[model samples]
Target: MSPRTGVRLVTIFSAVVLAFFLFGDWLARRDAPEPLAWYETYRESLWQPIQDRSLTLLQADQALGRGHLWMISADGEPALVSRYNLESDDRLWQAQAVIGLGAEEMESLVEAQAWEPGIRDQPVSPAVGEALGDRQILRMSMIPVEPLELNRIEGTFGSPDVRMPVSEGEAWVYPRAGAVVAVGEEEAFSIMFGLRDES
Candidate 1:
């Protein structure tokens, strides 16, 4: 092969590699979920119950098998009692107890827990009847709540529990205006707890 031909081939290969890298980077950034203010509010609200119950957010990986954003322990015994996730700038969460703890305590607990080690695991659906609250709560036995892509609304359910005939392995649950949400069949939809005004 001639030196000129070799140099031209090398240049073409470099251009292709550069283009691939640029395209991958742009797609990753575009697919990233949007930041949500409600996530902060909802996180604080969910942690309130744990603090109120005197449970501590463990520094260990408490939620290994159980799929949830945060995990807490009462008396050093870790239990997956709460669930939280962020989708499309919206927050979804579900807890065993109501979230009405004092703001100061919740804030402090959240701050302390922030420094704790994170638990990485696949998202899991909450168990049936585990999400007890004042309002209506249902379990999605058909669909399993899996993470969804940014701005993608496929296989998602909306707020207000409406009993309608759904195909097997397909269900949707939307978070109410003042309710707690637990991941159900899809990341976009989750099992919602009853609403309680903080004020």
Candidate 2:
């Protein structure tokens, strides 16, 4: 074949190959199942009751089988925090809860256990449990089983009510939902609920 004809033939072959691959990719994407939404997954999980302040520190411990506990001040108020791990489908998921403690509760905790008030994760003493178990959970945060991309969140929920720069990520807060999504450079890593109300 002539050089010109050979060049044209090569270009046509390349174009056909590119078109074939593109079409295949499109078809594959079209046939793929839609991924579960982050909110839906969260709501269906055992952590749902925590969002409505229905779960107490001790109840959560019983349900999640006891996690690491910490005594810390949240917004200038004494609070009890716990972290739990859930193993499912060979993957590990983590959740955290912050329970607001009253001054009386803090006094009780201090008197009952050897713990000094500070931000540290320590073993939960039976005395501490008895003191704060019934305290209402103020916030719940979780690391999802699957990574959630930042764009997907914005696309689904629109602009957040509050967007602020946080350590290692940006916090996207939705006041009406009382939720905050911590988005890193690529994807969202953590989500928290019960931060605020619609009003």
Top lDDT prediction, candidate number: 2
lDDT (Cα, tens digit) per residue for candidate 2, span 49-167: 65556777777777677777766655554556788887642445677888677787777765555555454544555566666678888788867677666655666556788889987
Q: Return the lDDT, model 1, position 21.
A: 100
In the range 1-199, model 1's lDDT, one tens digit per residue, is: 9999999999999999999999999998886545433334444433333323332322111321223433344344322333423333333333332233345644554454442334432222343213322221121111113444324332132233533335433343333333333333544344333333344
lDDT of 1 at 79: 26
Error of 2 at 178 (Å): 1.9
Q: Which one wins on TM-score?
A: 2
Give candidate 1's error at residue 88 in angstroms.
10
Q: Which ten residues in a row have the lowest lDDT in candidate 2?
A: 33-42
Deviation from native of the Cα of residue 162 in model 1, angstroms: 22
